[model samples]
Target: MIHIYLCEDNNRQLTRWKSVVEKYLLMNSTESQLYCTANSPDELLEIRKKSTVTGLYFLDIDLQSEKNGIELAQEIRKYDPRGYIVFVTTHSEMAVLTFQYKVEAMDFIVKDEIETLPDRICACIKNAEVKYKTQLDSSSRLLSVKVDKTSLILDQDDIVAITTCEDYHKIMIHTKHGVRQMSGSLKELIAVLNPAFCQCSRSAIVNMKHVVKYSREEALLTMDNKETYSVSIRMLGKIQRALKQL
Candidate 1:
């Protein structure tokens, strides 16, 4: 069950969006509840209050608040990283900042297309639904890895490598999405990882699927992301065997 949240300061626009979203949900038989409609980000956040309900958010960039939609999404990530954030804004220029901050924004719908705005909104919501359901379908294939205080459900296929971070009890996870810092026993992490994953070095394990090139001379394993990790001398034989299977 997905909970949809909307934050738009303009009364007319907010009403229109609410109508459009409701229509989309009804037309597609999507199992989502319209959770919140707030004129202020504070109201929305206050209502959410530590609830980690998975869902989607349609936010207006110009919120006329201390924090705009993007900033609110950042704050929301602190509590609910699983939710999808789709920005509805008049400004097209701020799109770059979204990726730079690693918000992982699903889509952006410009408010300029007044007539087709509702249709565009529907498309974005549909896209979010497809992506969300795809993730849910692979939920059984995901490993729930804890990064600091945040718990991330990661698809093993997206994982590239896991390496000790030099900090005590910390591991750095390299994924197709990006690097994540987590705390765990290397033994614990390796034990939970898939068969394609194996330790290459005393401090690192590379996913065979992500290993693009393996250098025996340099004892280096290059991942699909181009990040290179050293192979321990003892694990060289195991690494070679794994590389041959790939």
Candidate 2:
């Protein structure tokens, strides 16, 4: 389920947006729920920590506090990297700041267009719900690996590749965020992973979902993130078949 959050400072605007969101929720039967509403970034962040699932956030750019919407979004990303963030603010000029902040806001909604505010908000919710459902469905399977003292539970879809490290006893997990070194064997890890993972070589197992292009001549597989991995000649046929299934 996609939890929804709203953060607006002004009482009137807050009430208006809350009303619109509540009405939309009542009228439509979706997996999205109006989770929380806050008058301050602190309040929102406080509650955001409790959410274990992805969220859809509608934030006012100027929150009249030290942490504005963009900054709050940066903080939110640390916890919910795959969540949707939509900025609803009167200051349309602040839209450019989202790019500088690297928040990847789904949309910048201007409150000046009062007539369209409700529609835009609902639209963002609708679009986010569709995307959230897709991710939730694909993420039913999880991979748990120990990174140092911490155990990280990851969505199988997020893993780009897993390769044996130089130490042989340790493996390197290549994800979109970064690489993580963990103690494990490729054969052992493959036993726990889904069918989407294919061992391209003795040292590396690549997620078929992340395989962008494969060159049989070069015996290389290019990932969606542009990282390349070599495939053993014996595994070329298996890799080709797996990619075709994707």
Candidate 3:
């Protein structure tokens, strides 16, 4: 389901835009389930921190607060890098400012051209949905591990186990060539992967797809590679539940 967030401060404008968006969605039979409205950057940040959003944002470039919509978009990118951002503004010149945020904004709808705004927004939403789906299909979760000065993309399925060595976490991948060493933090790596990957222990996050069998009593995970890894007692139930879903 798509989760749309509208951050417009003007009550009348907000109502008009909301109606436009809702009408477009209904006409197209869009599968948007959650719609959040915020008047300020602070409110947007709060909603972003608490919610798992997966759709377009119709943000006002000029807000009534200290921080503007561009600043809020930068903050949103930190957590949700894939969300579609669009600027709704009175000043068309502000379009260049989007490059500073490094956000691939779908479009900038000029408030003066409010008559055409609904059609423009509808097109952007459809485009964003297509791009989002394509990304999900083409990309598997990659754990980037820095080996010396170079970084490599380690597929989650290729990982056998993780072990920490001093400050860095060593990732062991069962490649067609052999096992290889790549460095990263287990905590940071987990954030990029799907939540379905459960931590067997402090050092290892066994991919749910690779787990062939799990022992709750011993807190152990046996992968499809026939290698066994120990899970901490605290994570036993999580591992068991993840394995069951397979």
Top candidate on lDDT is 2
Best TM-score goes to which candidate? Answer: 3
For model 1, the local distance difference test gives 0.81
Off by over 4 Å in 3: 140-246
Number of clashes in model 3? 0
lDDT of 2: 0.87
| Runs in model 2 lying further than 4 Å from the true structure | 140-246
Question: What TM-score does candidate 1 reach?
Answer: 0.55
* Residue clash pairs of candidate 3: none
Predicted structure 3, TM vs. truth: 0.58
Q: What is the C-alpha lDDT of each candidate?
A: 0.81, 0.87, 0.72
Please provide, for model 1 over 1-246, each residue's C-alpha lDDT reduced to its tens digit, 9 standing for 90 to 100.
467889999999999999998998776654456889999999888877745457688889899999988899898787778888999999989999898888889888898889989988888777766676677556544577665465455667767888887797888888765677878867888887878998987788889988888777898988878899998889989999988898
Position 142, candidate 1: lDDT: 53
Error of 3 at 11 (Å): 0.8
Candidate ordering by lDDT (highest first): 2, 1, 3
lDDT of 3 at 97: 88
